[model samples]
Target: MITIILICIGVLFNIFGCVGLIRLPDVYNRLQAATKCVTLGCCSILLGVVFHYGLSDAGFKALFAIPILFFSATVAAHALIRGAYHFGTKLGEKSVKDDYKEVVK
Candidate 1:
């Protein structure tokens, strides 16, 4: 029952992540969506896998993957966003506040 619920939640978040990737206007926002939502969704699914298959090799792999996913997702997102900034990807028209502008000044 818990597994089913977790799977559903994961799927929902995955869908939202994909939608955000497609719908967001700028690279930074898309990266934010992908990193936050997809990582969270994938993590939940991996945890469910661990719970469903405890102590076995599959469980161990899932357990290992959780931290790897966390680390890699964060680092990759950071790198991508930084690269986008370096390349001068413009912010969407609706964006408020130029935080980076202030920092760079």
Candidate 2:
């Protein structure tokens, strides 16, 4: 019941992430959106797994993975974007600002 609901919500988030990845204008925006949404989605699914399986091995693994996924996804996204910026990737035409433009150099 609750597990199913959580799983469904997670699935929706994952779908939204995929959509964002496809529709966003630039690499940075797309990666940020996909990372954030997918991280939350995967964490939610892992939580549902914990609820469904309790303290079993699989549940424990899923529980452990939640934090790893959350941190890694965000950190990886930041690193990738920073690297892209440093490598001279241009911002999208519609981007209103570049917070890193002055600070990064």
Candidate 3:
């Protein structure tokens, strides 16, 4: 039962992430959506795997992947956003503020 719920949640998160990728306005926003969604969705899936498999090696592997996915996604998103900022990919005109503008200038 718990495994089923986790899998459902993971699937929904992934779907929402995909929607975010399509709906977000700029590269930075898209990266944020993709990173957060994928990491969270994958983490849930991995947790489901751990639940289903118990203390088996595969379960352990899935458990280990959760942290790795979280950290890697965060770092990768930050790096991409930084790169986009450096390259001057203009934010959508609807953007209300530019937090990095002063730093980049």
TM-score of each: 0.88, 0.91, 0.93
Task: Show where candidate 1 strays beyond 4 Å.
Answer: 102-105
Q: Which stretches of candidate 3 lie over 4 Å from their true place?
A: none
Q: How many pairs in model 2 have backbone atoms within 3 A of each other, for residues 3 or more apart or on separate chains, i.e. clashes?
A: 0
Q: Can you tell me which runs of candidate 2 are displaced by over 4 Å?
A: 103-105
lDDT tens readout by residue for model 2, 1-105: 889999998999999999999999999889977898998998899889999999999999999998889788878988998888899999999999877788877
lDDT computed for candidate 3: 0.90
Worst 10 residues of 1 by lDDT: 96-105
Q: Candidates ranked by TM-score, best first?
A: 3, 2, 1
Clashes of 1: 0
Tell me the lDDT of model 1 at 14.
94
Worst 10 residues of 2 by lDDT: 96-105
TM-score, candidate 3, is 0.93
